[model samples]
Target: MVLRLFVPPGEGQHYIVPKRPDPLGANATLQYVVLSSTALAAGYASFAARHERRIAPPTKVSRTALFIKASGRLGVWAIVVGAAANAYYHRGFTTVVVSQLVQDPTPPKLYEKTDKYTVEDGGLAGAAAGFIAFLPTLLMRRATVPWWTRMVGMTNIGAGTGVIAAHAYFQYTGERQKAMEELERQRSRRMLEFHYIFWDKLLMQRLDPLLQAYVRHNGIFRAYHVPAEVLDAPDKYGILSMPATEPSTTTNAAAPEHAPYYIAAPDWTEHLKALNTDFTQSEIENSEREKEALLKEAEYMAYQLSLKQHAFVHSTHTNDDDRQRCIRELQIMGIAYNRLRASADEADRRIFAGRQWLRQRAAMDANAPKASWLAEHPFIPDPEAHDPSMSIAEIRKCEDQFKIEIQVFESRVRSEVREDVEMRERWRRDLDEARTLLRATDGILWELEKKCPPKRDVGEVEVRASAVEETPKVEEPPKSLNPEKP
Candidate 1:
C-alpha cells in the first residue's frame, strides 16, 4: 500500500507525494503494516502486564512472556521516536491544510504584520504525529530544529520512560517475591503431607495386607522364656480371676456420669493393725478392680475416637473443618486414655506389692528373732540410716522420730519378755512347743543322715546312675549336716 501525502493549494504547487520503499530491501508498506500491528500488540501486552505480572510470575510461568513484555516497552519508545522523526520531517505540511487565523482583521495597511501573526490551526488530524503535546510547536516550525528544543524533548521522553521503567521494576520484583512466597508455602504444605501419604495412599490400598504381614513376622520378634513374676499367678498371688468387666465398663448405674466413687485406702503400717491384713488386701483388690474398669472405659473411648478421626483423614474427604475438629478431639481422647493407663499401671504395682507383702508375711518363721517384734511394730527403720539423696535436716528429723519410737518399742519388748506367768505351766508350754518345732525342722533329718549313713540300694541307685562310673564302695567321712539351700 502506498502512503500518499497531498499538499494543499499554495503549499508547494498542488501535488501528491507517495512514500517510497526503504532502500534496505524491505517494502515500506509491509514494514509499516508489520510494525503497526506488532506495536499495537506490544501496547496491549504492556497493559495486560500490569494485571498479569508478565504472565503471573509463578515458577511454572514461562519466561517468554516476560521477554515479550520487556520488548513491548522498548517498542513503545521506538514508536514514539519514529513518530516524532516523521512529524519533524513533515513539519511545514500542516500550514496549507490548516485554517489560518489572524489576531485582528487583515487591514490593507497592516498586511505584513497580519501575515506574520498568522496562526495555523492543525486541529486533531495533524496532532497525531505531533504527540498531542501541550506545548505547541505550530509557530516554531522550521526546516532545522534548535538544539535546545531537541534537548528538552529528549529529556522529557527519557525522564518519562525512566520513571515508567523504575515503577515497573519495583512492581515486578514485588510480584516475583509474592510468587516465590506462594511457591514456598506450597512446598511447606507438601512437606507436611509427605508422611500422611502412607496413611492416605499406602495404608488405604493395602492395610489388610500390611497387618497380615505384621502378624506373620510378629512371632520372630516376640519374647521367649518369660519370667514367672511377669506371668499372672492367680493362685500364688491369692487373687481370683478378674471378672470380665469389659461389658460393664461404661455402665455407671449408681453414679451419674460415673462421678468417681470416693474411698481412700490407707497403706500397710503397724498403726493400722486394727484394720488387719484381710481388710487391707480386700481394699487393694477393690482398688485394682476399679482401676481395671476405668482402663477398659478409657481404651474404649480412645478406640472410638481413633476410628472417628481415621474416617476424616483420608484424601477423599473434602471437608477440612471436620478433619481439623477430629484432630483436636483425638488428642483429648488420647490424653484421657494415657491418664487412665498410667493410673491402671500404678494400681497394678500397688496390688502386686501388697501380694508380695502378704506372701512374705505368711512364709515368715515365727521362731526368727525379729518375727514377734515385727508382728506388732512394722517399719522399724534404723534412725541413723538414710538414702543418699536425703539432706542433713531431713535425716535429723527422721532420727528424732525414730529415737522416740525405738525407745517405746524397746521398753515394751523388754517388759513383755520379763513378765512373770504361772511357772509350771509356762515351762511345760515352752518345752512342748520347742519339741514340736524342732521335730518339724529338716535339719533334724540332715543330722541323722550325717551320723548314720543310709544303706545304699544297688538296684535303686544303678537305674539312674547307669551313665556314670560309680566310685568303689568305701567308708566316707561324715559331711556337714547343714548344706546351702538351692
Candidate 2:
C-alpha cells in the first residue's frame, strides 16, 4: 500500500492512535504493524530536521545555473532557425503540388481539388521539426547536464547555433581560467607565508645557536678575523649561542670539539641532491692550488704595505723641510694598505670556496679518501686528519714575519711616543710661565687693596629741642589752701 501526505510550510503536527489487538492468532499481524508505522514516522521527522540544518543557503548563482541560462538562450535561437528552414522546405513542396493540380484538365472534385495538407498543418510540421532539431539545446538547458554537453555543443554548432554556443563556451572557459589563476595565486601566497614564518620563528630563533657553535668550532671567527662587535650584532649573526645573562665576551677559550663544522636545515641535503652536479677530487685539487696562489700573493702584498708604512713613518721624523713629502708618502701607504686588505679578503674567499667544494665532493663519493689531497700536500694538511699543532713549523715562519712587523711597529710607536712626550714637556713649561704672569697680577691686586682701603661713614648723631618747655612748667596753686585765703 502507498500513502501520500503534504505538510504545510511552517507548521508541524503529529497524530497517534492506540488500539489493542488480541495476542493470539487473529490480530497479531496488525498489532506489530501499527508499532512499526509509529517508529518510522518518528525517524522521518528527526532526520528531516538534521538534513535541513546540513544544507547551506545559496548566496550566488552557481556555474551550473549560469551555464543553463546561457544554453537556454542558445536553444531558443536554434529552434527559430530550424523552424524557418522547415517552413521554406514545406513552401516548396506546396508549390510543386499546386502546379500538378493546375495541369489537371478534368472537372475538379472539391475534395480532390484541395491540397492534401493545409498551411496550418505545414506550420505545425515545421514547428515539430524545429523543436526536434533543438534537442541538444534542450539538453544543455537542463541544470543536471554533464560538463561535456556544453563542450560538444560549443564545438559542433554552425552559424546560428555555432555563434550562440561559442559565446557560452567563451564565458565558461574564461571562468575556468580565472579560477585556475586564483588558485595559483593562493598557493604562491601560502608558500611565501610559510617561508617567512619558518625563517623567523623556526630557523633563526631555534637553530641559530647550533650554527654559531658550528662556526666557532670550525675556527670561522678567527679565520675571517671578525671583530667581536660584528659577530655580536643581531642583524648580522641572528643569535648568539651563549646565554644573554652570561658575560658577552669570548676570550681565547677552546671551542667544544664535538661541535659541528656546519649546521644546516634537514632539507639542505635534499636541496644539494636537486643541484645534480658534484665536484670531483681533481676539481678540489685545482681549487686548493688556486687558494695557495692567492694566499701567497696576499702575503707578498701585505709585506709591501708594511714596508711602505715604515718608510713613511721614518721620513716624517727626518726633517721639517720634508714634512710635505712625508705626508704624500703616508697617502701612498694608505692606498697600499687598502690593496693588501682586499687581496687578503680574496685569498680568504678562495680558501673557503675550496674547502666547501672538497666537502661536497667527499659527500658524493661512495668511497672517499681518508683525507683530502689538501691534507696530503707537502705545504698544507687537512686540519682534521692531522694535529694542527704538527703544522707549527710552517706557522713558525708566519709568526717570525709577524714578529718582525710587530717590532718595526713597536719601534715606530716608541719614537712617536718619545716625540709626543718631549712636545708635552715644552707645552708644560710654557703653561708654567703663563701661570706665573697670572700670579703676579694677583699680587698687584693684593698690594693695591692694602695701600688704599675702602671706608664707611659712621659714629655721629644730632638732636634739636624747642625752648617753650620752660614756660609750660609755671604751675597752678593748690585748690584746698586757696579757699581759706580768698
lDDT of each: 0.38, 0.36
Candidate 1 residues lying further than 4 Å off, grouped into runs, are 1-275, 315-320, 360-486
Judged by lDDT, which candidate is best?
1
Question: Per-residue CA lDDT of candidate 1, range 1-486, in tens?
Answer: 111122222221111111111111111222342244344545665665566655555533223343333444444565466656444333332221111211121111101111111011111122232234424543555513333433333333333343344334534555334334433433332232222323344332433554334323432233123234323433233322221111211212344332422112234443233223433454465556657676787789888877876775654645888667777877888888888888788677667656655554554433335443342224537423322222322333443443454454344434534343323343344334333333433344343334332453212321324323353353562232112211
Model 2: per-residue Cα lDDT over 388-426, one tens digit each: 322333333343443454454344435646555544543
Go through the candidates in order and give the clash count of each: 0, 1
Indicate the residue-level lDDT of 174 in model 2.
54
Compared with the true structure, model 2 gives a TM-score of 0.20
CA lDDT of 230 in candidate 1?
27
Task: In angstroms, give how far residue 282 of model 1 lies from its true place.
Answer: 1.4
